[model samples]
Target: MAKLTKTFIDKVEPPAEGYAIHWDDKLPGYGLRVTANGVRSFVAQGRVSGKAIITTIGRYGLFTEEAARKKAQKILQDMREGIDPRAVNKADAAMKVTLQDVLEAYVGRPGKLKASTAAEYRRQVEKTFAKWAPLPIASITRDMVKERHAALVKGGLEGKKAAPASANAAFVTLRILIRFAMDEYRQADGTPLIRDNPVDALKHHWAKLGTRTERYIDRRKIGEVWNKLHAMRGEVQGYEALASVDLTIFGLLTGARRDEMATLTWDRVHMDDHDPAECWWHITDRKRGEDLQMPLSSQAVALLRSRPRLKLADGTESPFVFPSWGKSGRIQDARAPMQAIGEIAGRHLSLHDLRRTFTNIAMRECLIEKFRTDLLTGHKPASDDVTSRSYLNLTRLNEWLTGEVQKIGDWIEQQAAIAASKNVVPLQRSA
Candidate 1:
């Protein structure tokens, strides 16, 4: 062993296998280690409470010999005082676990979270708790949660609406994340880093959301929205804008969820312009995990037939029906188009509102059976009886769905024709 100098370190040869350590003649338990791959690092070796431990000070290039020796002395001194450097490092890492880290862990497991569900959870955390993301999960206090929840309800944020429903939804997502952290991260004594969930403080203060308000478009104004959308479809400039028009109409016609309809591929959509009866769309990512083969109305078929496959920069075609320039290569947001239609129809309307209109027309107008309507909308059956499970599902209802959806389609067309002859009546936008 020799005193480790810069010249000596640079001249040291790496071993052919494993590693070689040259103990410093000047400082006990301090040495330079060279691995087979020529990685040279300074290390401190000492006994901590009877067990021998070695800790790396740093790599040769990053830490000079003099600086490495200083770090080694400090590490050796800490070991003598019964403090294990490994334990200290572990605790430091645990302390730095942030709220964003917890969210990543929560959504990263295979098959635990669906793609759509994961995307929604990420959006909620990124947009709602953006300030709290980088802060350690353990630092989130009950008071902070309560204040943020109230702020969300009051619409204190710049672009957010003062809706208690969205506030409650944000907290629900936070509670899920904190609970996941309680099980995932732990301290020295094996206890969880998070002892109690801060969101639990809002036990009785959660908002009471309702569906009793005007959640759907008025049946009388359906034709007006339909006509306005078609007119806008012709005037829109880009592919994405035009897609917004068709996607909104498709949402109204099929009552499918936004993600389900947005991610539709040409492979999943089977259509025949010659025969409307042969046209149908298949959805594998239903919210309930059920596979559905939904029949398309003549209106839906025409819309799909008109859409051209989006050509990529490389001359290949995109798989999505509604392709966009965004990273996902699919139509993500149609709220702007929906909002414009809402103005003409007399109120603000969401895609879900269009879904409600479809259900309303099917049940209240055509007098279709509730079970058949449920099938068309992909709702779980109220009855779990053997016969309902065995014989009465999507497979058996193909013809019935075709006829029922066609009737709704016919009703919407008739409304459009009648609305053309009368003066349009506009309504106030809801606050």
Candidate 2:
């Protein structure tokens, strides 16, 4: 075999199928490998513990012939000593790996992260940690983390101070990433690449950020907000616009999340069940990663009944309750209409605020028990008592929940009527 050279490697032809290897006569166990797919790589072939082994050095254009020979010589020497150079190279690569590399692996692993979670992680990494993407994972120090954390809170990089909540979120994301890397990556000696997570420093000494209070309409103002939302139906023109009004109201009535209401499908809405007790909305997938069957309130059922069924050109009805021509194929956001409704209410509101309003009204006005309120809102039970839960029948529990929710709905209607009367003035003012 001719000694592998740049000129020889350039002229070598790949086999029609499979792969071909040309060994160098001058350098034992050093060779060039060519594949049918037009790949040309330098390789080292040797025996370790009496078993034949072949290890790729690198591609031709990337590694010069002399460099490849030198690498091959080292690899062959290692093999003779019963040490695998590939393992050593892998350990070295692990030490030199970047945060971006670990993130891709962490998110790409099967069942490790949900699509929404993966998307959020990608956003934070790309937007917040762009500068740190290329830094070696092993080289990340506690001081570096503290500096980044301080920089994020001070808004030094972005030119304006960020919200403490936003800064906290970035720090939390980094903590999770570094923790994941520590668990997954290892050094040549099989020890964890990260000894102690630098994020621990922040957790220990940094002044903890307080949780932001959830914004919800006050109990006394629920009537005014409900009446304003009902009036908005007339001001809005299209079916989708009207649907947004209904969706906002439904959010208040049922305490469902924005996506849950927006993405509700017909099949999940069991409106015509023979048993009123059995009538419920089945959320097949929820954020907490479980199926939730929430019994519909009387007002909720009426709202769903009023929605228009959209049909395609083929005469097939659309699956989504709040169908839209938008890219998501459903009513994704109702920010504009919600903003208008909030203005009328005299307080800024969000879709989530509606859910909070439901909970507040149920607890304070309706006098519903906390456990039942939690159940109605699709929150996990605080009491983990197996005996209490076992004795409870789901149908009976739903029946009780439906009654409680109906009380809130009825109260809101009464308030709406009172609010309407205030809008009316006696005609005797002309006298």
Best by TM-score: 1
For candidate 2, write residues 1-431 as lDDT tens digits.
88688888988888999999999999889999999997999999899899998999999989999998998999999999998776788788888889898789888989767665676688678778898888887788889888777777666347573434456677788889999999988776678989898888787645344322546776656777788887887788876787788888889888888777887899988775466666678765555635777888778888888888877667887798988765555785576567766676665566877888888888988899888888788876546757645675543345567678888889888878876786766568665
Over 4 Å off in model 2, which ranges?
6-29, 34-40, 45-53, 61-64, 70-182, 185-214, 237-243, 272-279, 286-292, 311-315, 337-350, 395-398, 423-431
Highest lDDT against the true fold, candidate: 1
Report how far off residue 237 is in candidate 1 (Å). Answer: 2.3
Candidate 1: regions farther than 4 A off? 1-16, 22-32, 36-38, 44-53, 61-84, 95-107, 119-182, 187-214, 273-276, 287-290, 315-317, 344-349, 423-431
Error of 2 at 65 (Å): 2.3
Please give the lDDT score at residue 242 for candidate 2.
75
How does each model score on TM-score? Answer: 0.75, 0.69
Question: Could you give candidate 1's per-residue lDDT for residues 166-267 as a string of tens digits?
Answer: 688789999999999889777755678888999999997886554644678788888887888888888987878887888999988888888888888889
Worst 10 residues of 2 by lDDT: 205-214
lDDT of each: 0.83, 0.78
In the predicted model 1, the residue pairs found to clash are none
